[model samples]
Target: MDLFIRYILIGIGNGAVYAALALALVLIYRTTGLLNLAQGEMALFSAYLSWWFTTHGVPIGLAIAFSILLSMIGGAVIERVLIRPVTAPGKSHLNVLIVMLGMFLAINAISQLLFSTDAEPMPKPWPSVSSPGDPVGRSARLLDIGNTSISWAVGALALTLIGLCLFLYLLLQKTKLGLALRAVASNPASARMVGINTSAMLMVGWALAAGIGALAGSMVAADRGSVSPGLMTVVLVYAFAAAALGGFDSPVGAVVGGMIVAIAESLTIGYVDALSTIELVVPFALILLVLLVRPTGLFGRRVVERV
Candidate 1:
């Protein structure tokens, strides 16, 4: 029983990371109506930035903050310089996909070129046992109960996910800027007529998504005690599954979907011997299941078009 409980906690930690990234995906999809295939790579670069900051003597928290800030700026710049031209109103949305796919490869290659593919240890905020050579482990316990213990890493992940949920709720539901963003998302022509700068709102949306990705990327790398150019690749897959399962338009659903997917993966991995060599298939299967059964997902709003 303790072992099962421990596995559940581990799944929650991984789920928190997935929820963070899925939140970013849903945010962008909601605000800009574009799915960024390169979102993970953008986050990979941010993780590298945090790692670089740490290597330069910056504290872990502050380093993550810096990474978020820079990633926000970078996101805005990318939107203005690369994405804007393709995503202009009346343009083919297919261009958006093509550009994002290109960015997927480009950003990964750039991060590797700039930082090298070598994986490096990242400093953790919570107490952890990690060495220079092997930088990730669940060593410090946050809670102990009989034979089951929760690690600080897991606690941090849960807290961060909760905090992110609150922050996003406040930002998107309670603030003027968020209201304007929502307006733009709903209809840019209507929003522009109301004196909102649709382009600026779009840029803000990208910036916000990138900043969230920065947090997700940094925390995942920190928890693992490693950051690398390809750090978010596999994690991105799970995140996508979470987003799809929860509904791409629903942030809350993303969180729930992440937890569901993670728990399912954990249980299957723990008890199913046949999946030993193909664990990643768990998320892919979920994705297929969700798509086939409920395309809009649990919380996603369905789109109705006049034919």
Candidate 2:
């Protein structure tokens, strides 16, 4: 039972990371009706920025903040300069997709060229606590439960996820900007007729998505203790699976789906010896099952359009 609880906690930790990425995916999908294949690469670039800052003696928290800000600006610029031109109403979706794919490859190459292909260790923002005798500090563990322990890093991440979720909920449900964004997303023509700046809202959506991706990437890199050009590839796959499983249009669905995926992956690897080598298959299988049973996703609404 203790072991099970430990695995569950660990799964939740991993799920938090997936949820962050899935949220970004859902944000982009909601606003543009398209997926940014380069989202993960954008995140990878932000992670590298954070690492670079830390290596230059900047505090980890400050470094992450700076990275997020830069990522948001970069996202806006990309949307304005690259994505916006190709994503006009009459433009082909394939063009935007191709651009995103090209960005994926370009960003990966840029990271390799600038930061090198070598993996670099990232310092944990929160300190770990190892034992009862350990002093409470940045390195101290949060708590010890039964035979298992939760480190400060995991605890901080969990808290951060909770905070982010609440902030998003409020933003989407209560803010004027959120309402405008939703209006634009629902019907750009009508939104523009009503005086909403659809283009600016689209830019905001991209910027917000990129900022969230930066956070997710930083957390993942910190957890793994290293960052590299391809750091986000596997994570990107899991995030896609989570977003699909939860209903690409639902933020709550994304979080729930991410948790489900992580828990399933954890249990499969921990108990199913034969599947240990292929644990990544678990998320994809879940995605297939969800699609077959409910194409709109577990929490996604079924859209009805008149012919």
- What does candidate 1's lDDT look like per residue over 281-303, in tens digits? 88778878877888898788888
In model 2, which regions exceed 4 Å deviation? Answer: 129-139
Give each model a TM-score. 0.94, 0.94
TM-score of 2: 0.94
Write the residue-wise lDDT of candidate 2 on 150-219 in tens digits.
Answer: 7776787788789889989889889999999888878788999999999999999999999999999998
lDDT of 2: 0.88
The deviation in Å at residue 102 for candidate 2 is: 0.7
- Model 1: runs farther than 4 Å from truth? 129-139
